[model samples]
Target: MQTLPPMLNLNDLRFFVMAVTHGGFAAAGRALGVPKSTVSKRVAELEQALQARLLYRSSRSFTLTDAGRDFYEHARASLIEAEAAQEAVQRRVAEPSGTVRITASVPTAQQYLAVHLPALARAYPRLHVQLEVSDRMVDLVQEGFDIAVRSHFAPLPDSGLVQRPLAVEAIVLVAAPSYLAARGVPAAPGHLTGHDGLLTGVAAGTWRLSGPDGARMEVAPVPRMTVNESVVLLGAAMAGLGIVPLPQELCRAAVASGQLVRVLPDWTAGSVTTTLLMPARRGQLPGVRATVDFLVNCLQPAEPAGSAGQ
Candidate 1:
């Protein structure tokens, strides 16, 4: 039968190393911010555990035995390694100097994350950001993503991840000015049927709209083009292909630039809440935390901007 190695107390070893290095119990106690008696007791306990006499003590002086010298050398080496390990971890925590892998929807990545990343990089010079843009729901832990930005109409499904609200995104009908000029703007939800529709996969062919007075209407226009990605639908709308519903944040610049104009101004095509999510474990990491804070600050400003139309 194999025998297990003896267990050693690291704290006791540390005390012994400190006592020897400081040349006396009182000095070691002062250095460690403890009572001298506590230092002496810890050293005694270490010696007892080792089953060897490690020090020679007199009222006037202190000395180390040959055995104590050998033990001290090894103990001091262990302390050095422990301190180095601690400092290595602390340095990473102090500086956000690592790759942060993020997964987000195509529109969020293109409109919000991709455009804003340069600012984050400038703020955290040592941080490397990796973005994965997709519309599929990502398994954060399984896919090794540090964070994710997700959009939802209802509450997010229970995925056991920590979620922080990023923005409440209002979906609005948008069309290229040329398209609206050619097809004429819709007076209300009922009139949208006369206009060509560029539909996203999530919306299928149906649009659910809410008016200013809490009245809801659902319209299903024949799609001239269908896309699974919001960014693609936004592009199709900007190309004067058809009217499409998009998050206001994604189309805000276009609206301001006269590339696209809001249709049915009194009615909105419902809203979806955007959230930042991460595995509970990754949420505590310094790099992940910094990225989350940066995104939160960026997205919060868009909320008021989105509501300015109302």
Candidate 2:
């Protein structure tokens, strides 16, 4: 009788490579156009066949067990070879052409799609995009959004969403020049407590008011007028309601126009970051890939590099 190839399955090996590369089974599943559970099962089967735990899964992190470490050392070449083979097959096909729908928050929605999209539209005339702007989270499939750009810390759940980081910007504390001159600039960060605060429902939207000797505190802002949207808060700041913590993009125009002044130039406040998220499917649609490629270029720091770049 012929002996079956030692303990591991090639398919399982493929799944393992995908998991490590993508950082999780779900992400791998999205890339492979398979259900997340299918990815999990393949990895589980591989572990059983080898009688070795390859991945140490934790609530917060994923690590390679000793066996996984050893496998990674060698299997990368095999994976690369397989990709080369696949790419050779795909090259015979024509370039991407189709309609793509993308979603974004107010700021990027206006900046990228409204202003810059014309260039992309001119390049791939056949390639069109339906743009949706909103602050609420979108269900890509249900809402028919082909891709989305938004700021978030946790990766989108394994629910058929593929997320890639773009860039991160600090949430700056800014006020109108008149407001600062009138208040004579607070003596310390704590004095900010006395100033009005613009608030939002988002976690990163919350401000950590800083003070002396690492003296720090938080402002539970109940703005006389609260807005869930970043754009609205920015408008409130421009109108001089009080101090608002905002992403650089939100205040950039105002600061340049002298409609707003950056406060506490030395002290950092909150942050705003963005990610590119898409639906999991084999052979990405033409419109989707185009947007992804452009966004990769748009969000890069010094061309491109880790975390978001990765």
Across residues 65-138, which tens digit of lDDT does each residue of candidate 2 receive? Answer: 98898987567767788789889767524445667888887777865556667777776766767888887888
Clashing pairs in 1: none
Give the Å error, residue 40, model 2. Answer: 60
How displaced is residue 207 in candidate 1, in Å?
A: 1.4
Q: How many backbone collisions does model 2 have?
A: 1
Model 2, global lDDT: 0.71
Which stretches in model 1 have alpha-carbon errors above 4 Å? 1-92, 301-310
Q: Residue 125 CA error for candidate 2 (Å)?
A: 1.7
Task: Note the residue pairs that clash in candidate 2.
Answer: 171-270
Residue 129's C-alpha lDDT in candidate 2? 71
Over 1-310, each residue of candidate 1 has an lDDT whose tens digit, in order, gives 9998688899999889888899999999999999999999999998888899999998987999999999999999998999999999887679887899999887777777877899999999889999998888889999999999987667788889998888887888899999988888888789887778998774468887777757788887767998867778888999999999888878888899999999987778767678899998997888889999999998772442223221
Q: Candidate 2: misplaced stretches above 4 Å?
A: 1-94, 153-155, 201-206, 209-224, 301-310
Residue 44 lDDT in candidate 2? 88
Q: Which candidate is the best by TM-score?
A: 1
RMSD of 2: 20.6
